[model samples]
Target: MSIEHLRARASICALTLISSLTLASGCSDDGGAEESESTDESGESESTDESESTDESESTDETESTDETDTTDGTEETDTGNLSCEPEGDVTISYSIEVGALDEPPSVDLDLACTLAEIDTDGVTQVLILDCPELENVAVIDIAVSPDMSLPLVGGEAISMRYILEGPWWFNTYLRLDVEGTGHLLTLIDGDSLLPPEEFEFTSPVELTAVYDLCEPVSDGCGQRERLALMTTIAGEEAQIFDANYAEVGGEEGTEIWVGAAGHLHEIECTDTPDEWFQVLIVGPGEG
Candidate 1:
């Protein structure tokens, strides 16, 4: 009821109000702290998600590199070089021998082995290249004579043989035979001259036999020296005609020329050994 008492009561009321305001401010500060903590948690979650995304990208890059390596390995498994030729088949060669002229009866037929050797050459050694490896560069020609066959009045018999080289490539080429032990290249043809389609009407061997068989006056013109010269002449004309005879070069005027040609041809290895059997290999240009 006094003035001092009233002042003291008013001071107490002011102190209470100040305390209430301080408590309210403290609560507001606590709420702001909780909000800030929640925001920090959210930031951490986003950082973790970004790290997982980076890991996935690195794994994809490694997988792509592995695929590239597999592709490179596939390309290395295919590469080879040159190829060679091999033998495959064979062919037949037929030979017919007769003791008389065309359309003769009692003829003998012979067959020989021939190979279908396919090869490539520059046209020069086509025959040698096409022949079988066992008989390469060597020609083997044989004749079969039977007891039933008869020798006509004429000296030599008629003989023929056919050997077809397989394939279209051999049609345009030629067949050449190199005489064994003789430096002679003989081409077979069917004419009285050295040309295509090989054939022969008379051979040197037959003529040599005829020189002895058909000689009536063996003591005079058909002596051994004269017969040797005649044989040389026949052999020389197998490739070409020289028109060689005793009548053409018998006297002293032509004796030198005939003797010279005979000497040159006699040097051939074929003339060294004279026999009744004709040469099957040397298919010379004949007097058909």
Candidate 2:
């Protein structure tokens, strides 16, 4: 069971407390992602296209040449790449933004505006900028947040495209994702459209079997029962939580959870599990 298909190339940044974005725009790899062949369990197909490197340590110091000028802080580095995901604390709420590329067609810079509380949260979280090789395709066009939010966006060539933010009551928008050319494997659609991803596959590390359970008791409703789950086994399917440990989980079994280096595979649940004797271990997301 060697089923790879998890992009996520790192190089994620989105620092925009509330303002400061000056795009210059330009990107082109034409419309990539039309080459696939990754089969290993001994079936042999190999040829995933090869080109993975989002370069994100907090990257800054443009290079790909477009019209180079700024020396470092002189202000004039145009290859067009400015990311902003803000909304972690002091949240006022209300959002609206839409900007497309790759021929370009989705537009709506900001339409709805503030005020809504019942339970609509997840302001913004999906950033990775600076390396916009002029941007051949950078679209998040129509950012509407209010009771409907489900963002994922990670790294270039579309690593984790998961967007669904219905609007109406609070809006603030700005989205541009084109981290250095080669077609951004885009997909963030539910109402307004945007789709691109014909193929993509890459996976190499395998060896799993991790289970842990202790949830159930929010008066039985199990709101998330304290939280402390960590299942595993990706590709073979049926057992994937990756990581979640709110705090006390006693006796820790082996314990070693980093969950990074591009291995994302989330699928957590908590409706009930008072404990029926479950605590198997043997996890790995480390030792890259």
Candidate 3:
């Protein structure tokens, strides 16, 4: 009876042990599968983040490249159009003496001819009177002239001349040949001058610059009052010649005058030099 009982008990215990071992192994397999799934999900999230960062970097680089192209185009626009001054209208000159002198070829342009007046007025004084309605100045240009003329007033080839602005207003100025020899139209500047007149030399070439300053008037011996005027130098050197005076008192602007020899003149409108220079032209007559 004791041997049979011991054998049965041992067999039942062995079966129970086998079932417990099987259950523990199944639980371990489930935990390992969950850990593998968690690792795969973390790797996928990191890949997505890397892709988005690369896309943002490319977009930023493209935006920076576009701004560099626009800055280069703005520099080329300022070179060619420096001075745009031109004659506003028909600029003419007249004299107080006889109309017999043949002003045939002396004119504003190189090829254009002058107006020849054939009137035989019997006047004792032979003065070159400048009457420009546009310029608004009734100034005398020349004190004496031959009833007969002998030279052609040419531009870019006239005689050089300089003048000192005498009297308060540009009422009077002294003139002479700019070069050593005479008998030529001394101060005919044909074109507009360059800007920023500082450090400029008034040489043989017809170039004028400007400076902003004050002007005052003067009274002559005959009790005549001259207006405040503009003064310029020859090649930015010696001898400041009086060019123009304020047309009216307390006026902010004035008419520009180009003083050429034999009283050849041209007047243009100019604004008040409020701060920077507003293109003031200082020219004189040279040998023609």
Candidate 4:
């Protein structure tokens, strides 16, 4: 009886061991599948994140590029582009300029609103990057007339008005004028901002009735010596001032003739100034 019991117990134990091994193997396989699935999910998530990051990066790059392009376009418009260089009708440029006077008050301001008489393309136009906005449409008026003053113009008059551009950044400014020969400096600026002033004697208006008044014909009121001096002053050229023809106030000479008038080429007289004197109404160089 003891041998039989022992044999049966050994067989049962062996069967239990086999069953445990089988269950353990099945659990291992199931765990491996779960682990693989988890790894695959993690990989997918990383890939999605990378894709999103790449898209975002591309979007940011495009935005930056667009901004750069816009900035470039805007800068280009500022340099050479003008809202209106040529106004519709007669453009009356009202500006003030101040220059350093050679005399006292190194700062001499000239506030003048001159009518753009005509476009005199005798001077050169410079392509400068001004710090002022008003300079965007800068049409220089080179021919300026002298207003009918006590001491009027005998020959002609053309004081070049300069453009003064000055500000904090690259877009601010004013204007100025050192009245030729007068030495008295004047500017057409409103503020006290430091500016880089530039002058253009290039163009004038078509029909500008500038303040400059015509000179009087040589006469006793103007005086003989005075007329010669006037011609020399306005002609600008010392050589040519009294080089033109001359006439007496009266048809006849020795009528207490003080000086000479720019009468004509043929019908005229020579003067003591050596150079003949032909008087023009306008000063400087005027078309009329």
Whose lDDT is greatest here? Answer: 2
Q: What are the per-residue Cα lDDT tens digits for candidate 2 across 89-131? A: 1111122222122121111221121111112223542222212
Q: Write the per-residue lDDT of candidate 1 for residues 1-288, one digit (tens) a residue.
A: 332343333233121100000000011111111110001000000101001000000010111111111112101111112222112111111121111111211111112233322222222222121122222121222211111111111212112223221111001011233222332232221111111122312222122211221211112111121121223233233211111221222222211111011101111111111111011122323221
The segments of candidate 3 whose C-alpha lies over 4 angstroms from its true place after superposition are: 1-183, 187-207, 216-236, 243-288
Best by TM-score: 2
lDDT of 1 at 149: 13
- Give model 1's clash tally: 6
Model 3, 1-288: lDDT tens digits are 232342233233121100000000011111111110001000000101001000000010111111111112101112222222222222221121111111221110111112211112224222222222222222222221122222232222323323221111001112323322333233322111222122322333232223222222122211212121123333223222222211111122211232221110112111100001011122233112
Q: What is the C-alpha lDDT profile of model 4 across 111-210, one tens digit per residue? A: 3333222222212311111111222222222221112111222222233444322111111122332234542222221111112233312121111110
Between candidates 1 and 3, the TM-score winner = 3
Instruction: Rank candidates, TM-score, best first.
Output: 2, 3, 4, 1
- CA lDDT of 26 in candidate 2? 13
After superposition, which runs of candidate 4 have C-alpha atoms over 4 Å from their true positions?
1-155, 167-171, 191-288
Instruction: Kindly give the stretch of ten consecutive residues in candidate 1 with the minimal lDDT sum.
Output: 16-25
> What is the C-alpha local distance difference test score of candidate 4?
0.18
The runs of at least 3 residues in candidate 1 whose Cα sits more than 4 Å from the true structure, single-residue gaps closed, are 1-209, 212-280, 284-288
- Estimate every model's Cα lDDT from 0 to 1: 0.17, 0.19, 0.18, 0.18
lDDT rank order: 2, 3, 4, 1
State the displacement of the C-alpha of residue 218, model 4, in Å, after optimal TM-score superposition: 59
List the RMSD of every prediction in angstroms.
54.0, 23.4, 44.9, 42.9
Of 1 and 4, the candidate ahead on lDDT is 4
